[model samples]
Each structure stands twice: as C-alpha cells, then as structure tokens.
Target: MLLDALLFQLGYNAALVMIGAGLLGLAAGMAGTFLFLRKRALVSDAISHATLPGIAVAFIVMEAFGGDGRSLAGLLIGAICASALGLAAVTYLGNRTRLSEDAAIGAVLSVFFGFGIVLLTVIQAFGYGRQSGLEGFLLGSTAGMLRSDATLIAVSAALTCAIVLLMRRPLTVAAFDPGFARVSGQRPDWAEAVLMAVVLAVTVVGLKVVGLILIVALLIIPPVAARFWSDQSTHVLWISSIIGGLAGYFGAALSAIAPDLPTGPIIVLCAFGLFLVSFLFAPERGVLASVLRHFRFRRDVHMRQGLLALAQGHPIFEDLTLKLLIRAGFASADGVPTDTGRARAAKALRDEARWREVRGDPAFERAAARYDGLTDLSDVLTEDQLREVDARIGPPVGAA
Candidate 1:
C-alpha cells in the first residue's frame, strides 16, 4: 500500500495532485536558493501575504464583470497584479524611507494581509455564490484541485526551473557579490529583477497548493535544511530541490489518505520535520557533531598538556592521565618519557612557545634570547633545540 501510494497508483486524481504539489516544491526550492543567499528570505513572505489582496480583488472584479468570481485565471491575474504592487510598495518603502528591508517586509505583510482579511469579510457579506470555497486559498485545499489546475502548476514549475538553469552562473554571481558582479561588467540588477520575477511566478502558481500563508515556508525551509548538508552552492541547490519535492510528495499523499486534513499545513509541517532532522544529525555541522568535536578537541589538549608537564620533570597529578599516555605509546608504564613521549613533548613545547611569542609574552622573548640569536620562535624546533631552550628557561614557570 505504501509503495503504491508513493508511486501514485492510488487513482488518477490523487496522482495529479501529488505531481502538481511536487513540481511546485521543486520550483520553489530552486528559486529559494538565490533568495536565501541574497538574504531576501522574508521578502517571499511579504510577497505571499501581499497576494491575498490580489486574490480577493480578482474575485470581486470577476463577479462585477458578470463572470464566475472563482475563475482560476482571473484569480491568478489578480494575485499577480496585487503581488507586484506589494513588491513595489516594499521596494519604495525600503529605498525612500528610513525603513530597513525587514521593516518594509513586516509593514507590507501586515498591512496587505489585514486589507485582505477585510476584503474577504466584505465578500462573505455580499453573498456571492462562488465565495464559499474562496477561503480555501487561505490555508489551501487540494481536494478541489482539478486536472487542469495540476497541469498549470506543472507548466509553471517547468518554466521557472528552465529560467533558473539557463541563468545559473549570472544569478549565482549576483547573489553572492552584486557589487563585484557590477564592476565586472555583469548586470547584477537585471539578474536580480529576473530572479524576483521567477519568485513571483512561483508564488502565484503555488497559491492553489499551499495558499498564500504557508507558501513562504515552501520557499524558505527546504533551502535552509539543505544548507546543513553542503556548503557548495550547486550541491545546496540539488539537495534543496530534492528535499522540497519529497516534502510535497509525502505531504500530499498523507493528506490524501486522511481526507479531513488540509494539504498546505501538512506540507509545511513535513518540510519542518526534515529541517529538524537536518539540524540534529547532519555530519560535521549538526548539533551532535559539533558537541563531539568540542569534546575531542578538549581531550587532545588535555593529553598534550600532560605530555608537556612530563617533559618538564613535573609530577603526574592524574593517574588516569598517566595510564592514557602510556597506552597511547607516549609514556612508559613507569610514567617516564620514552623516546616517542619526548618527541611529542618537544612538539607540544614548541607549539606553546610559538603561541607565547605570538602573544608577545616577555618570558618567551627572554627565553628566545638564550637560544643563540633566535629572534622569533615561528617554526617548530628540533628535540635538542627545544631541550636547550627549556634548560635555559628552567621549566615553564608553574610546572611542579
């Protein structure tokens, strides 16, 4: 049953919805990479909330024109127009006023979304026949998605992907270093405009699947989760796209299985789950990995300090430290420095001496003068060379 559902063997309607949702995920993930890198992640949120007014206006305008207010194309056109206006407002506020980009985003998001709520209430009061299902666009409902809607989503997603692929290099350059790109004769502003257009397109197309409220999650989460897995831009893009597609596929499938559930929140929750997993377990970067690396570093430093103390003929204070050093072949069972132990101790001493010199310690300067014209202890000294300095210095000051 699981395999069949996964492979889309569970009826044509379910398959269509799943495919559309997956494609939407793929496109959002790809475009979101540039958005994430440019630090415009919240811009997507503003744009999405901004679309709500567009959708409401589109429905009202269609009803006035004696057409069905729920016509998908008219609704989408309204969404696009309203979103563009919102984008312009945000840009204007950011450029012309003292508002920062985030402030502008927050302003537009709240104001436009508030206006949309008012408009929705007005529409509800007007008693339009098609207005009943209009609220579905708020939280999204895939149960109402027809084959045509799925096809439209698929085409839009494909177009968005194609644009990203064709302009990948320029987009990457602009995203990473716009000033350098402009100096190098590339039109960074133009590339950025094109990228924003792609974002708008994806946002518009995704309205039916995830709605305006949760759509930003689709744009932001996958790329963030993918970041935990790779540092390279190309790899991040691929991983993000895969994560997004999987989230869409599984979220839609699960929602379909449980007919009472809404699809948009499910999809966002699935993406968030993937993000949590990445945060906890990704190699080298995850929480567990970072903690392990910290402990390992402390252990190595502790063992190195023990070796240094032994070289200075100081008493070993910890019996476990002595046992560990002997087991590692750095000391004899009698707690005395073997040849390997002496060599390791000399290296540790040189490292400490170099660090002290870098830190401008007067003691290290005086010690250096005793080593026959050595002005800087920048390089590691031989065992004999280090021993001569150590003898002159008379064992680091605190050694017991």
Candidate 2:
C-alpha cells in the first residue's frame, strides 16, 4: 500500500508537471524551429541573458513608483522592456559597428548582464525585502512557482504556438529562401519579427524553470533532434515540440523532488539525452543504423562485383574466395555465391534505383552501375526496364 501511494503520488506530480512543462516545451520548440532555420539561434540566447537587466530595471522602477511588491506583473513588465532594449542594442551594433553578429550579441549580452548585476548587488546591499528572491530568475527554483505562473506560461505558449501555425507557409518559405519570400511579396522581415516574438516569449516564460543560463538548450536541442527523424519542416516542428515538452516536465519534476537538483541542468540533460538518442537510433539518420546499412550495401556491392568477375571468367581459387560477399549475405553456406542471393541483392539495388528516380541522388548512380551494365536488378523487369537501366548506365568499355 505504501509503495502504491508513493507511485500514485509520483504519477500525480508528474502529470501536473507534464502539463505545464509540455506547454513550455511546445512554445520553445515551435519558436526554436524557426530560429534554428533562420540561423538566429545566437540572437535568442543573447535576448535570454539580456532580460536580466530588464527584470532589474523593472524592479527599480517599481520601487520608485511605490510599488515595492515583487509581483509577477512587475517582473514581466521588466523582462519585456529589458528584452526589447537588448534586441535594439543587438540590431544597432550589427548595423553600425564593425563587429560581427556573434560579437554584437556577446557585447550586448555582457553589457546588459553587467548592468543588471550591478543593480542586483545594490538591491542586496540595501537588504530590500524579497530582493534576494529575484535571484531565482538567474538560477530557477520550482519552489517559488505559483499556479498563476504556470497559467501565464501556458497562455503565452498557446498564443505563440497559434501564431506559428497560422504563419507556417510564409515562415517556412522565408526560412528556406528569404530573397524568394521577398520577391513573392510575403514580408519576410515581418514574418521574422513575429517568429522572434515567439522565441522571446518562450524564453521569458521558461525562466521560471530552466533559468537564463540553460534556456538556450530548450531552444536548440529538441529541433536538432527532430531533424534526424524527418526532412519535412512541419513534422520537425511537431516532433521537436513533443520532445522538448517531455524534457521540460521531467526537469521540473526532478527539481521538485530532489532539492539539490538544479532545474536548468536537469532540463538541459533531458533534451540532450533525446538528442543523443535520435543521433544514434533514429530510423533514417541514426549513426549506428546508417553505418550498418552502409556496411551491408558495400558487402552486397563487393559480392556483385565478384560474381560479375566470375561470369566473365575471372580466375578464382577455392581458398581465395570472396569472404566479404559471403559475410554480406550474397553467398550461400556451401561457400558458393547462389543465384537466389544474387537475385535478392539485385532486387535491393533496383529498389534503390527507383528511389533515385524519385529523389535524384548518389544512390541512383551506384545502383545503375552495380551490374556493370548487364543485369537490370529487377525480378521481372521487361526489355524496356533493361534498356532504361542500360541507357542510364551508358555503354561498356570499348562498346562505343
């Protein structure tokens, strides 16, 4: 019964965290997709760090206006203001100074963060009530979160995600080819601004959990992971959102249960783990799977080469046999290459040829050249198919 209760409680908390973190993740992932595609990922990072000064300045302004209460509203207002300023500064430096974009982001980030730090130090020195509480922004704490914070995060995420969905076509076009988007009169700049707003909002909302230091991980890892699974931009966005959301909630729950566990690192670790898994095991792009496929393909190719050599009367000793072809399944248990195995290999090569016909790739070249202009590789290919493959391969040596 005790174990059941513990498990039950874990499930309950995990569910709640999942709902909130999932929203956060969706927001980050959706917005991050565009940022990654547009190559503005660094700018997002600079904005996240730059929001610190905005939060500090908002606090200062609130105090001056007799609003000493460190309310969420005050923080939001400050964060927005600071983030806008940072964006402006980055844009200005990029336009005017000799500094490159990365250098500009670094400069704006350092300067704004330094200013915020100075203000925070002053607030601490004065021993302002709950002034130390703002430090949570720098190193996020689930302990400080209220239900309202989650609501804010959810609402912001929803709005941002909705905007992304609505503008998917134009935004995708712009990401792939901004010049073309402009020629098509799509207002790529405006599309980019809208996307940047989503990114900024996600950063602000996620600050309650992942903090500024590691929020960029949420914006980067999930989309990158999703890329391994698909070539379509829409699928990439959806998959990235799911992966990012799972990471966020897991991070939040871990931080809640283990007081020592830092939320930022935990969230980052979860996203990174997903990325690593995708890198190693994703069906089409996984390193291990691709390498295995490549090995099998090479083995089959070498086996076919050996068989073609045999058909052309190339001398072969029993002991000097084709071991590589045997290992690749092109030879039988009797240490002799079987017609059935050769046929199967030919079929595989034909399928690859079809893939090339549709996609036009390197696989097509290899597939066409596999039989040295002899076999069409298809099981029941007609004379037309043979002619097509032969036509694709070009004449054999001295057959001009």
Cα-based TM-score, every candidate: 0.84, 0.81
Query: What pairs collide in candidate 2?
Result: none
Q: Which runs in model 2 stand beyond 4 Å of their true positions? A: 1-18, 315-321, 325-382, 385-400
Pick the TM-score winner. 1
Model 2 weakest 10-residue run by lDDT:
1-10
The digit string of per-residue lDDT tens for model 2 on 110-139 reads 888898899888878877766557777786
Where does candidate 1 clash, by residue pair?
A: none
Task: Please provide, for model 1 over 1-400, each residue's C-alpha lDDT reduced to its tens digit, 9 standing for 90 to 100.
Answer: 6577778888898898898889889989989988998889989889989999889988888889898887777888999999998998999999899999999999999999999999999999988765557788887788867788888888898889889878878889998988899999778988888888999998999898888999999999999999999999998888898888888888888877875788899999999999899899999888888999888776665687687787677778787678778888988888888888887777666556654553454645544554422223444455665565556556554322
lDDT measured at residue 249 in model 2 versus the true structure, 0 to 100: 69
Specify the poorest-scoring 10-residue window by lDDT in model 1: 371-380
The number of the candidate with the highest lDDT is 1
On a 0 to 100 scale, what is the lDDT of residue 103 in model 1? Answer: 95
